[model samples]
Target: MLDHLIGRPSDNWKRTQIILTLLASTYLLFNGRTYKLPRSLVVTNRILKQYAPWRIALGTWLLLYLTKHTDILLGLDAPDPLRRMYKRSYFRGTWVLTALDAGFFTAMSIKPAWLRHLLSVVFSFYYLVFADAAEDKTRRVRASITVEHMRTSWEKAASNPILSFFSSLMRPSMTLKKVIKVKRPESSERAQLPPVQVHLYYAGNLDDLPDQTSLLLHFPGGGFVSMPPPCHEDAIARWAVQTGNLICSVNYGKSPEYPYPWAVEECYDLYCKIVESNGKVLGYRGDKPLKIALVGDSAGGNLVTAVTLKILTHNQNLLTSSVSSSFVMTSSDTSASIHESQAIPLPAGLIAIYPCLNFDLSCWMSPSQISLMRAESTTSLNGKSISHLLESKDHMRHQSPLSVEPDLERKSLWRRAFGLEANHAKRGTSLEERIKFMPPSMTDLKGANTSMLPSAGFVPRLAMTSRMSFFNDRIIPPGLMRAMAILYLGPHSYPDFDTDYLLSPIVAPSSLLAQFPKLYMMCGEKDPFVDDTVIFAGRIRKAKRENSRKSHHPEGDSESVTVRIMEGMSHAFLQMIPFLPDGDRATKAIGRWAQQILSSDDDTKTSMTKSKSLSNVAAIVTNEKDMIYRRRMGLVDGLYAGINEDSS
Candidate 1:
């Protein structure tokens, strides 16, 4: 069986090698045109800019063939850092992902739905095996945040050894570690949701914790269906080390099982428990006050924002002497006690990374949506000169001699040959297509004028691009996103929008937003959620401005809202940290933001920084020369400039 699984190479393999050589040379030749350097210098500085789909597809396929299908590249005789650029490990992983992506796109109906169901099964199994193997070697944590309260029938079943046995078989690596477990809530009478488990990570020994350690509640992104992978553990552990904080990552209930409101309820309950007990739930025995921040990415981002809104709504009702029935307390006694205090304390800040703020993703795009989508391209300028392609005179004087291009016409040709030509051809065919959705509930958001949320039967635009468009993003493609939405929201979609902020936090009223603590959001320029994040930030900024004016609060009195857009990045890039340079940069930025917020005095009349217009916002880019090799090997290198990060 082993011999059969790893088959012998044939003439077809040789033919494939020849074809790959020709294609790789073509890519190298294209890169060559950008510089008038000697032929001996094959590898140059301008390698990361290569963006051909064909090249990426082939590179991934060839990598799989060399590494998995055959042992050709695994032998001792195999070239070290083949071509003096691609590191063995990075090269192997990049290509395998590329091949997997190609398969996933096809399976998800990038071409057609003919074999989608069959391919889905095959790809699912393949992906699970690969993920399990990867996690097997990666470092894992032993600390756990066991749920002592809140239980459901599903949770009881999940804890059954017979049921868990099958689950373990499916995920051997994960099960073997026993890194997580769901326990029955001590008081089953108050159970409203499934069992919730959180994972704790600290830089130092738990016994040696600081006097006043900060707490960061994290939600790892998996489109609301999957659990937090091992990769998140490493990042969170690093964050805890850097900030000296106790980080508890939530293992919220998944979709098609627990779905929409369940995850939000779990998160809110866990948060209340932490705050109400003053971090005792997570084993914190510090003498000083506990400062907390909520951080999440993608689906997790949605959860954090929703929980924050839920807290605001709860506080608002408490002030009005009519606690909303939608808000549920961990217990009847706790609920009664909180009514006197009138509010649960808010977190120091919120850090949302590429969150899907809106669930009412319709088939049609609003005029604003289309405009935002088109804003990234220079091609949309209609006969406008591409003068921005050239560096400023001052920049050119300082640039290296080898990097400079003196000939104007040659420079133009080189730029276009690289990627500018494709950007100019707007009329070229795109994979974007119309997708009808269930009627969106307008009630989900209330009392907010200028809400970014779209309602049912909105006026359709003449030339609208679909929200789920290949031109917009490839990492979280249209089909996968649609599947996730349907699974999480159900077939008819979320019906109770007014109370269900988890469905789409973008629709939350500006009044609620104004009361929100300092919010720090980050997303990739190429992310599908970029438009939603930008719109949400704008709404928050506007609300805070109005509230400050009305209350006559000074400029520094209100907390700042910061938005960071990573150039040339896609959704969920957080998982790539310590691998891609940009990932490390993003992680470092998160640590900095957390420290700043946690250390600052809320009553202080000083503000960190004010947000500027989106146009003027500075974006985070990776311009380091050392990253060229990683970029050339298909690693994320922020080369494209679109929307910028804003700090207010």
Candidate 2:
């Protein structure tokens, strides 16, 4: 029965070779421990192993046979051409015999039931190796023909009948509903509208409220690309509820689809609509004015600042008529030149998180500063002159808020060199040229009615009235502050309009500080932006001095700007969950500050007390904790002893 199952043998030598091959293959299969290698190499070796078993079996048989019968093979290796052919034939025959032996042993290792199935699967793969070993020209030709026929048959079946049948059966199912039912709620508890394209989470009543009511406008930040719907929604909602303020969360248009100017326009449009419809009852109850505030994070901060600037610029009449109260802007980067206007008092209290103010300057220029200048010159000039200008201009003006003097000089030179004087510079030269040469001067600017611009001379008085908060992190490093100062005072003249340009020390805190009467600058001790904030605070104080000395306005007073450094806080600590282990300390502080500002009739005294108290307390607490921790750890003892010994 075993003989019948194995079938007939081809020849004596072939049969003997197959037996020996089986023994060798069995030994290797059971005993060999395949070496492991790198992942890529392991895959390559596995493929090689599949062919190796057959090669080894055939090689062993041929070498043994040749060694046993060397004389007969050597006699046949006499004539040059014939001897070479014989050697090739002998090698080919040996490899073929080895492959068959390998396959026989492989079959023997499998269980009887699986043996037939396994052989069928492995036969085609084995045959490919065997065919390559064929020596006779006729045998090689026949093997190639066989392989081609098998491949063609496989292609036909794979392409048509069997494959097609399975594909048809496996096709995905699609069904359509013919009817739909709408359910209505029995009570007023049902959601009136299904989830829509934009979700707005609002707080506070949209109707008339008491005299102490306030309104918060929240704009989410996603670099003008997407909404920070999930992250900011809860905080904004909670703030509105806790403060008893109405919150209008705007879902502004995004980009690169919408682009810059359009998205900004959309924000302004939404704000206008809200004011038009709900302005009267926004922050106040009686005939008195309502206090409206704007708050946002990251890009949302940018939008808030831009909107506030717009309100001050284009819609002052409406703002002034509706409310004699001040507004608040938080975590914003809308000013075109943060450095220049760092000390400018905002209309209301201004608070900034890790604001990206001066940071945009880097993107506006290259390391050499030449590329940025070239880009600017090319973009500014019209006709065929643009291409020529980019190549010709060696000293490129870098756009930075810090370098006011150099920028002014560059602008003067550009106008004179390009023959761009107001008299000669042609109208409709190119949109680029027109924008370049056009002085930012608006004679009767929409928002500039002299009284509207925050009084430049109102330094000390303004500082007393305004509240500002600045938060930063350790990533902004100290050396970066000095680098920024150099850039600000460097030869490159940065434009005050392009807010996207990167500047040193990240954003310019001074620009905003100088304009607003109330200023609050806070940063984490470990934060990189800390050093910059410190330097900025010093600059603000200096500016306050200059303003006091130069101003003729009675409102001017000379007092140093206020600053705070929060312990263990990061860039956007307020947005963080729990805010602190003690429970959102920053938020509570902000709330208290807001309440005080709203209630206080004397802005100067109110702001002065608040700023001084916060700063002094923060410093004392930080110092005491450091001392206590060091003493507990025994670090203070050794240091104190060493100091005493050195003094003795």
Candidates' C-alpha lDDT: 0.54, 0.38
Candidate 1 global CA lDDT score: 0.54
How far residue 392's Cα lies from its native spot in candidate 1, in Å, is 23
All models, RMSD in angstroms = 23.4, 32.5
Across 1-648, the per-residue lDDT of candidate 2 in tens digits comes to 334445853456566677888999998778865563467867766666767678867977998978966855545332221221112323333343334323433343356644533563365347547543322322323233332222222222122243334433432221210111122222212225221122333343444344433445556654345443433443554554555554555555444444454444455555443333234422333233334455555455555555545544443343333222112222231221212111111223434443433333222222223322222222221213222222212112313222111122222334656686554333223222233443456433424322211233311111100001111111122232333333323453644433432222223333433443443344443233333344444444554555555675443432323344454333445433231321155555555544444444444321112233234333443454444555554876888889999999
Candidate 2, which segments miss by more than 4 Å at Cα?
Answer: 1-212, 269-287, 312-347, 359-545, 553-563, 578-583, 602-648
The candidate that achieves the highest lDDT relative to the unseen native structure:
1
Residue 433, candidate 2: C-alpha displacement in angstroms: 52
- Relative to the true structure, candidate 2 reaches a TM of 0.35
In candidate 1 the C-alpha lDDT for residue 643 amounts to 23
Candidate 1: the clashing residue pairs are 444-497, 444-498, 610-647, 610-648, 611-647, 611-648
